[model samples]
Target: MTIDSPSLAPAPPAPPGDTAVHPTPARTPSAAPERLSTRAKLVLFVLCAAQFMIALDFSILNVALPVLGKDLGMGQADLQWAVTAFALPSGGFLLLFGRIADLYGRRKLFLTGLGVFAVASVLAALAWDPASFLAGRALQGLGAAIIVPTGMSLLTTTFPEGPQRERALGISGTLLSLGFTIGMVLGGAMTDTVGWRSTMGLLAVAGALVLLAAPKLLSESRHPQRPRIDVPGAITVTGALLSLIYGLSTAAQQGFGSLDVIVTLVAGVLLLAAFIAVESRSAQPLVSLKMLRRRSVAWGNLGGIATFSMMSTVVFLLTLYLQEVLKLSALQTGLIFGVQGALSAVAGVLAPKVIGRFGARNTLVGALLLQAVFTASLLGLGVASGAWLALVGVSVASVGHLGAIISYGVIATSGLPDDEQGLATGLVTSSQQVGITIGIPLLSALASAHVAVLRDGGDGFAASTLGGIKLGLGVDAAVVAVVAVLVAFGLSRRADGGVAVGGRTGGV
Candidate 1:
């Protein structure tokens, strides 16, 4: 084990039976002292920058969608496509590309993703019509799908597990959240001042800069046993995710009553079943069912999806409340999220320490509970004047949100070996992307359905909207609360007093 800085030193070897599900690369100690070089630090910067750009694109177009639709002479369904196109490929292809990176080369995949993202951004910026713009967005989503899992695998492979990996993930998670908030602010400001195209231009520049630096800084890493592609598993899973995301995204805009939504959803479920069966029997499965059976991977992903979904849904609801109910300007709503972003930064910085002290399982459950409490507190909000409540609830809940984000990553990836790092991080990023994609649609649909009922009962528009928002918040809180309990039980202490998750004295 190479001891770099104190922070970079790898943890002591796990006891027998605690290694990994797959064969791990041997971790032999180096004779000489090893320090994380300036080049390695620069590499981390580039990786994080790429992740920041990915997160930025997720939220940046949201505020500018109306402007974009008007400029392109597009209607409501077309606008929905703008968002859905990006989400479809991004959420669908994560697991496939992640396994590919491990089989081929992470550095090669990372560079390819950055190039694709930069070019896609330029294409979107220069789009002349809805067809061109949707094409660009869909390509950008593919780029994002490749970038996130590859970059994360690179990060994990570079930094040995322990304080070093935790710290690096903290910085990356911080920038990720900050990027989303900053994009919201920048999207509104740039759209009003310059043009909506500038948002795409900004991503283009970021991607280009990161791409330029990454070639030199990144080292090639891949699994030792390069297995054949799991073609059947890949096709089934990818098709399943695309269908599911489309069904859910469509249901958010239109109700679930649509034939397309119903058909696609059923298709998605059927494909998912097929994928599971394929993976179970494949010689080299795209995803290992045994790995998924790991306590850490299973519960950690559960917490991750829950936290991400609920927090994003809360933000979306508040965005509606701010704009439609209180009639705040987009810029004003962005600024409010800006404050939450700032608080999130603080939380991110502190997350590693919180995990270190409380253990990842405890920290995850606690964070979810904190998030639930603060989210439920938003019930105090009214249609007339509850701007402060929105600001306060979101800001406070964001701390737990960030904490959960970091802790879940730590838990999910902690016990995994180098060969499987890509697959493990794939699961983590999948949780994130799938969460963000589904959260708003699922909760918003419920809210919309409720609002229709309220309106039918003779409630005013403002009252109906408020009632819907409250219902969403309540469900969000309830979901998080329940998941927190499940995670607590799922990752509970083992008979020997060791953690059941990470296969160590304590998980993470």
Candidate 2:
């Protein structure tokens, strides 16, 4: 499994999924390699811009949902589809495209994805109906699926492992995390001030500028062997992920007990089974099943699933609590998260120091424990108590979430040589996009079920809705808490066996 470094293309940046916190390992920026040339700086800047563009769209549409619904005469059930449509394709297609990027050229794929995203942005901006908008959104997701993996591949290949790459990755990771907050706030402000279309227009403008500059700034790079596309592996994995995400989201609607949910989930599982079979046999597999045996890769992906799924759930549900329940303006909701986002970025900035002092495992354990506490506090949330409690809890909770992100990224990609970095990053990215794809809808469904129960008992719509939200938050907190314990235990076992993980002391 050892990959000889063959002067692959400079790594672009961690794709959107691995972009949980910082791509930089747990090292100080001052420890980074000396004298980054002007061109190196440009490479970093261009890739970061692409990362921000793709990441921004993930949340940009979140705040615009209300306005989009109003403009297109859509309902709550359908409004969620806009988010899912983008997430499913984006998350599902990543491995397929990541492999493709490596085989053909990362630069080519990156540029193409950017152009596709730009065109998709324009399509979304000009959409006059729900179908058109959804179509555009899906295309954008496809573009992101391609762009993120290629971008990250470019990054790892560009800089050799150690301080220089860590610094570069930190920039990439920070920007990736920044997208969610920025999108929520920016989407809200634009939707409120101009229109939902303006939000789409903004992406179009940004994508256009990057699309033009990428070729000039980036040199082409690819895997040295130019491995053949693992078509069966690609098909099966993409199908499994898309089906799984779709099933998870559908379960939120039909309930886990519903026949469709059961059938769809079974199909997803079967597809994944098929994917494992295919990957095990393929010479050039899309995903190396053996990689999962590595402690850092396996456990790190688990941590990623927890951190991303749980944190994103908080944002999605909290936004509902603020706007749908409290009847706050989009701009107000945006401003709150804007502040939270800035705070989260600051937390990310401090990650190296935090990891240095606490060690990676401790950083994650503490962060996740605190996350559990803050998220649990939301269970006590009710509109009657005012927005302050929810705001403060979620805002502070995000800092802990920020730490988990950094630790997970460090864990997932740590100790890997350059050639395998793509596969490692691809897995991390998949975990993230899948987390985002499923978390909101999963909680949304729980919220709906709670509302249904309360309404059946003759509760008011407002009361039932609030009840549902709190219950969902309760569930979210429990999941994160459990993950915290499991990760700590697993990492502890690994550490006892003398494998450093999640910090300078270990593999991470």
Candidate 3:
């Protein structure tokens, strides 16, 4: 095996059952190295930078949407695509690309994804029309599909599994959260002062820098016995995800009555079912159906969906309340979100310690419960409710979000062998993107349904909107409560005197 390597993957756990899940990939000696070299640190920095870039792109557009629409002469009715385009590919293609990264070189794929992302950013920035801009966003989503899974697989492979890997993942997680916060704060300021285009342009510049450094700093790694790509599996799964998410997103705007939405949603379900059938029969499947049977991988992903989905729904509703009801400026809205972001950053750092004490399942359950409680607290919001209440509630919930991120990630990825790390990361990443993509639209529909009744009762537009929003929060809280129970009961007792999920005891 190659030595003195610059792998981005975290070293796996101690191999269990004769599996090579935790290989150091020619890096660390059998014993821990006394220290990492400067080159190793640089390589890590580049990887984190790539992660930060992906996360940044996800949030930067949040505050800029209104102005971007206005400047391009786009109608409000047609503007959702700017966000949907990115979501469709990012959430859609993750599994396919994760396998591709394993077949191709991680370093090469990482660099290529960055290049595509950068070029797409330029297209978005220079776009003079909605079509071109949506196209650009779609391409960005494709790059995200490539970047996220590979970046995660690299980080896992690069670091040693114990404290070293924990610390590295913590830092990487912090950067990812920081990117979201930074984007919001920066989006508001840049959109107000420079132009919304600056946000896209900024991504291009950041992506370019990461692309340049990655090839020089990061080493390539792949499976020893190469596996064939599963094309049918890829097409079916991506199509399913994109179609489902698109259908739901359309519901937020056009309601559930649209024929297009119904057709797509039904197609998505059918396609997902088909993908499962294809996977079961394929000699070389894109995703081994057996992986989903791993309780930890399965339940942890469900928990991840809960984490991102609820948080995103809360943010979306709060943004609407802040801007539309209270008439806050984009800058104010960004700053408000920035506070939660800062708290989220702090939580990210402490998440590892929290998990150690609580255990993974308990941590996830508690976090979800906390998020549910805080989200439900927003149900009391009204004209009398100050922005400070919103801030405190959102901030507190973000702390739970931190725990959810750490626990769910560890639960899903731990104990997996090296060859399957890409697949694991892809699944985890897809849950997150899907959660973000569908959360807003689905919740909005719930809110709208409630609002409709309030309007019938003679409430003003603002009051009806608020009433509808609170109902949505109540439902969101209920979801967390139910999932928390599911997470608690999901594990079976293991032989090693530990709770077993993914059929592993004591994490490989």
lDDT of 2 by residue, 1-508 (tens): 2112233333333212111122233322122333476778888888889989988998888767877998988898898788778888898898888778767777888899999999999999999888998999999999999888888878766755534555565567678878988988888778878999999999999999998888887887767788778888888889888888878877776688988878878988999999998888888788877667666677778887887888898888888888888898777887788777787878777764565455566677788888889999877777665578877888888888878877676667765555566777778788888877778778888788879999999998778988998888888899888988887777666332335323342224
lDDT of 3 by residue, 36-60 (tens): 5678677678888998999889888
In order of lDDT, best first, we have: 1, 3, 2
- Highest TM-score against the true fold, candidate: 1
Q: Higher-TM-score candidate among 1 and 3? A: 1
Query: Candidate 1: lDDT over CA atoms?
Result: 0.86
Segments of candidate 2 deviating more than 4 angstroms: 1-37, 73-76, 257-260, 494-507
Better of 2 and 3 by TM-score: 3
Residue 112 miss distance in model 2 (angstroms): 1.2
Q: Write the per-residue lDDT of candidate 1 for residues 1-508, one digit (tens) a residue.
A: 1112234443464433332221122343211112356766787798899999999999898889999999999996778898899999999999999999998998899899999999999999999999999999999999999999999999887776655676678889889889888988989899999999999999999999999998877778888889899999999999999999999999988789999999999999999999999999998899999888777788899999999999999999999999999999887899899999999999998987776556677788899999999999999999789999999999999999999998888888865677888999999999999898889999999999999999999999999999999999999999999999998887774533225333222235
RMSD of each: 3.6, 5.4, 4.3
Give the residue spans of candidate 3 off by over 4 A: 1-40, 492-508
Q: Put the candidates in TM-score order, highest first.
A: 1, 3, 2
Query: Of the candidates shown, which would achieve the greatest lDDT relative to the real structure?
Result: 1
Quote the lDDT for 502 in model 1.
35
Cα lDDT for residue 458, model 1?
A: 100
Q: After superposition, how far is residue 18 of candidate 1 from its true place, in Å?
A: 18
